[model samples]
Target: MNWLILVIAGLFEVGFTTCLKLSDNFTNFKWSAGFFICISLSFYLLNKAIQTIPLGTAYAVWTGIGAVGTVLMGIFFYKEPSDFLRLLFIFLLIGSIIGLKIVSE
Candidate 1:
């Protein structure tokens, strides 16, 4: 359940960050609302997850998910760079996240 909460929190973290960019300095009413809601939900779930998961492991996975998700969103949705080296770094980050999870478990 803790892992599940972490995953959900990560997803919401991604959503909130993306929405934050979309909010355009909080001018868009809908985006602003979504951003706030997602941010709150993400943090709440993260707090719940940390109840059982070690702080270091939970934080690592949480940030990893958010980083990867944000980069993907930038590439696919925001027309950002997709250079090979950048993608490789993202994969490396994922590898590190997985390694940490395994070690934690």
Candidate 2:
């Protein structure tokens, strides 16, 4: 259950980050509101997850998910570069996150 919450929190991290980009330095009211709401929810869920999961492990995984999601969003939505090396490194990051999950047990 906690792990599920952690994953949800990580997803919210992605949501908040995307809103941050769309917020245009907090000038845009809707996106800025979304940013604040998502961030608050993300942190609240993260706090709940940490009640069961180790701090370091949970934090690392959360950030890893956010980082990967953000990069993918950048590529797909912003049309950022999708070069081979960048993709390879993203996969490597995924592998590392999985490794962390395995070892954390």
Candidate 3:
């Protein structure tokens, strides 16, 4: 259950990060609201998750998921860079995140 919450927290972290980018520096009212709400929820869930998972491991996983997910969102939805090298780097990030999870367990 704690692990499930951690995963949910990670997803929320991704959502908030994407929302932050979409917020246009907080000028976009709707996006800014969503960003803050999601961020609050993400942290709340993260606190719950960290009750069982070590702080360092949980934080690393959370940030890794958010970072990769946000970059993917930028690439696909915002039409950010689609270079092969950039994608390869994203894949490497994904691999590192997975390695972190595995070692954490």
Candidate with the greatest lDDT versus the true structure? 2
| lDDT minimum window of 10 residues, candidate 3 | 96-105
Give all TM-scores, in the order shown: 0.97, 0.97, 0.88
Q: How many backbone clashes does candidate 3 have?
A: 0
Ordered list by lDDT, greatest first: 2, 1, 3
The residue ranges of model 2 lying beyond 4 angstroms of the native Cα positions read: none
Task: For candidate 1, write residues 1-105 as lDDT tens digits.
Answer: 899899899999899999999999999999999999999999999999999999989999999999999999999999999999999999999999889878886
Number of clashing pairs per prediction, in order: 0, 0, 0
Report lDDT (Cα) of residue 71, candidate 1. 93
Deviation (Å) of 43 in candidate 1: 0.4
Model 3 C-alpha lDDT per residue in residues 19-49, reported as the tens digit of each score: 8888999999999999999999999999999
Model 1 stretches with alpha carbons more than 4 Å out: none
Q: For candidate 3, give the lDDT of residue 3.
A: 74
In candidate 3, residue 90 scores what lDDT?
84
| Backbone clashes in model 3, listed as residue pairs | none
Candidate-wise lDDT, in order? 0.94, 0.95, 0.87
